[model samples]
Target: MSGPIPVADYMRLALAQTPQVSDQNKTEINTNEQGYYMKQDVFGQGGDFITSPEITQMFGELLGAWGIQCWKQLRGPSKFNVVELGPGRGTLSRDMLKVFSKFQNVVGNDISLNLVEISPFLSQKQHEVICIPSEKLEQDQKNLSPPSNSYQQGFSKDNGCPVSWYKDIRDVPKEFSLYVAHEFFDALPVHKLQKVDEGWREVLVDIKPDNEKEFRFVISRHETPMLNVLRTRYPKLFETSRNHLEISLDALLILEELTTRLEECGGIAVIIDYGHDGTKEDTFRAFRKHQLHDPLTDPGSADITADVDFSIIKEIFSDKALVCGPVSQQTFLRRLGIDLRLDNLLKAAKTEVEQDQLRSGYKMIVNDMGTRFHCISLFPKVLEKYLGRLKFAGFHE
Candidate 1:
């Protein structure tokens, strides 16, 4: 308590006394850290890192078009919802709304925008972005200010699209909705497990006994129920030496809930994140000021994330949802007409600087590093006929 206290210190103390801290408890550290966005700018050039939507307007535009096509396939409901999880700075939502506004005839005007965001700081930024006109967005960006009531109960833009914010996806009303989760799942907490002699033990954070202020990764004394599930579900993991596995049970639970909602109602979800379909490597990482750091070093000060295991996602929704491509982001965007959109933007560029900015954004999303990121789309089985044999642009070879 005297010197610098690690974010895990309090939890470690609780675990020492009770010795029964659940895996969920370990995940809370990360979630709580993320919820502290009010104290940090974790997005854009001024922050630690940037996302796809931040890289290019074309990214959001393509997704908006894709969503519109899916809406048509779903028979174009009179009233539907457009939801985005963790809509950082509201850039993607703004871009998507622009497309929706342009194609109002087909997309319809009776749509509500729902965002599941917990951070008050980000929610205000989102409100500002979505509520402003496209033409004024650039000019307003400089003079933008956080609303007095950061926790907006309800808001809307001039277009009459009611915008509401929720802390959890479950709170979003059940309806035909289009969902977008961009780099959302990676932020969810993951439980780290390592192969052990007895079985598999969870990796936890604890204060180093010799250096009370320092934290270290310590294995649990006994195997958890989660380990048993992993052993049964993935026996091959044990075959290797020092096998370390990280699984986001929180992410799986969210997907299950989303799948159920999609099946009950009628809609689709597109998930874009930096991860492989599936892998068996420890991907727990932290970023601060755009540089990687030890995740345990600074808890709330750094961004902690792991590569999503999209293979598990496909398996989970295989029956309930029509799971499509865990395809590469590059292929997905290109298939969604990113090239054509880029060319059009370039032709319209008024200056050399404008042209260069557009090119850099295009390259960032389609290059080798960007190609590693993946996009997966999910919809209920009932829409199969409407979708027909037509493969989604990114999902097909």
Candidate 2:
């Protein structure tokens, strides 16, 4: 309902208004103007939105199963760590370890549980979930119900790896392998661009004057080198018919760094998030409370995300890593044995209500996340022979 503002003035206004980038405030309106992640407001039943980990124990369990498969491929390293990025409520980590423990010792002094969380709020919550004292862990082990014959028969001989918590990926042992990032990539900041009469212009956020209380997006044409970089680095993307392209430099940088880190370390990193396949649209959008809202609605408050341009990613990393998925989460889970896991789970349920909830969770992953939510996986240094030098189908150069 307001007049459109040019992106240049918008960026200038936002930057001039930027409170701070680091240090104490913890509020992102201060830091994120410079491209940093704002702290998440994660909590009990009333947060921004619930993640897959919060949805069902099954998601974490399946990921745990997948991790175990990767670990087996790693020859069962006895001393590696289990790491999760942006651990919210620590549910996924807990669920992951639960499955990991079924195959290997979990609540032991040696295994380290490493959580890489930036928000103090989420980190404290994660600490409560994962860092149970050694004494209590021992007691819980004794109190734990005896494993079913299937678990005992399938994973009885496996040894549990130690756990370690890190605030940054650099802190994770370069040698320690298997990694999981569930819904992590989407939260990263992506640059929005719109081609113009003159040239390509970058989209930026600026505070509106009507009351300076809220922020809105504005596009400013670039007369400098960023335009060059955008044109050169993303030619195919720019050439596409989209009105704008939301570029995830963070995703690219993260993949690049992960490839370098795991090149010598040897591990598999699995990424599951709500996204799309090709590098084709401006999918920048936001969710407030639970429903979708205009992306310009709220800057720091709403959960903002964009559909992933995974084809661009393939172009970037086809040489170093074996990237799979970008497949449906439903499809990936099915291939990874989620159907078998759920059938056993539903049959084991003693009550109707419990069976219904389990069935609902299973449907959430397969039906909703299956088609709409994409899964992109990375097998660094592990799947070279299987994927190496292949033509890399699904995209044309």
Clashes of each: 0, 15
* TM-score of every model versus the real structure: 0.83, 0.76
What are the root-mean-square deviations of the candidates from the true structure over C-alphas?
A: 6.9, 8.5
lDDT for each residue of candidate 2 in 1-397, tens digit (9 for 90 to 100): 1234333222222322333222321223443243213344544357656777787788888878777666665554566466677676778877877776676543232444566665555655565665554444555454655322211101111233333455566656566566777777777667777878886787766556564555556676454355567578756666566677767665676677778866777766777777766645667676767778665543445566777777776666767877765777777777777778888989999999999999888887788767777777666655667553432221101
Model 1 TM-score relative to the real fold: 0.83
Best by lDDT: 1
Model 1, residue 124: C-alpha shift (Å): 1.2
For residue 198, model 2's alpha carbon misses the true position, in angstroms, by 3.3
> Residue by residue across 1-397, what tens digits does model 1's lDDT show?
2212222333232211112122332322333333335555689887888888888899889998999887886675888578999898988988888788888888777977889987777887887777744344454343545323323534345355667788888888788899999989887767787777877788866656665545567787887666677677645545545467667666877888899998888788999997876664778787878889776664556677788878777765777888888888888888888889999999999999999999999998888446778989998877666566656656775
How well does candidate 2 match the true structure in TM-score terms? 0.76
